[model samples]
Target: MESSSDTFGKDDSADAKLQESRVVTEEEWLQKWETNNIGFHNEQGHPLLKKYMDIFLDGRSGLKIFFPLCGKTIEMKWLADMGHQVVGVEISESALKDFFTEQKLSFSEEPIPGIPGKLLKSTTGNISLYCCSIFDFTSTITGKFDAIWDRGSLVAVNPCDRERLVTIAEIYALLMLRATLRPPFYVPDSEVKRLFGKSCDITCLEKVDGLAERPKKWGLDYFWEVLYMLVLK
Candidate 1:
């Protein structure tokens, strides 16, 4: 893995300008959806996910995996095929509907108590998509996910809101604090403790490589990127 500083050294100025921009909100993201501007959605499972599924799953079955900013990706199908349950969160109902329609999967929707949105559950254990906001998610709705796979959620937000997203991520970690796995790098333990209100034993923390893949929409700087994974304990 390359040094974070080295990666940002020459691009610091460009990054600074980018950071000064406002983070996109649910409404803004929805606007993107209305215009069919979702270029980030992948037609297949993430390469890194396919490569490390064995290492992450480790023969475990019936595990629950969380997908934030799911964006109609078929990764959930891959996880479900492995005998794991998938809880996906997305802010755009349009995208979620497209996912179901495209997959030819019929689902029933139910209201999420105390939450503004509803849950969409497929008949099969293969996938469950939540049409809700990420910040408003709780264990009551999502239950506890065994492993969290954040392919694009963390880096999707503008730099200003990245910290807030991290805090939310820590809360998610705390919810599954007793899970069999923990997060690798990118998410700090201190932040996890702050959000979880307790210390977490993070087993199998490793910075694996080869996560960089993007469509033509992403700039050159983001063409090659690193992604982190965790198995909570």
Candidate 2:
């Protein structure tokens, strides 16, 4: 496991350049989903998620779990199967619909009161997916959550929007609770601390290289998966 100080040296100019180059837009994401280019979508519900769920969730049951920038990842359904209510906010309606279609789960779609997109819910009512931008998400609509599972949500956003996302998470935490952030790309521990250290306590940081298949599929030399647990203060 590499420490923050070791990962990020004194001069963070390289990190800044990296973030600048990696900035993405909502349209790009929509296009990715439309063309079925979502290499990030793991059907197995993320290896770390299954392995560390008990420890991260701390034996909580029937909790409301929030998934930000959620693609049609089966992880949401897996979480629902764990006796927890899964609430996911996604910008792409196609992705949301695909989730149900792929999983062969029946769901109903209804327009959100003031939000831009509609809400899709499983017939069993254990899973609810809000098809809207994360910016449009408000407490009035989704209410609060006990835990937030941010798999690739942070890394998917434009670098400029990262802080705004953090602000939203802070507000969500005020009413709800803690978060588990897993960025798809490389994000230094120092940067994570800089973003959430004040409002949340950094409980755990672990580095693992479990997704061996992703790097080659995505045309990357290596992919490091970092697990970060943030306990809201």
Q: Which candidate is the best by TM-score?
A: 2
Per-candidate TM vs. native?
0.74, 0.87
Clashing pairs in 2: none
Model 1, runs deviating above 4 Å: 1-17, 174-222, 231-233
1-233 per-residue lDDT for model 1 (tens digits)? 22222222335335445544655666878988899876666676566667666766767788877878788878777777667888889888888888888878888888878988878888874688888888788776666666677776655655466567666666565222111111111223233333333433333233333335443334332333343334334
Candidate 2 displacement at residue 56 in angstroms: 2.3
Query: Against the true structure, whose lDDT is highest?
Result: 2
Model-by-model lDDT, in order? 0.61, 0.74
lDDT for model 2, please. Answer: 0.74
Report, for all candidates in order, the number of backbone clashes.
7, 0
TM-score of 2: 0.87
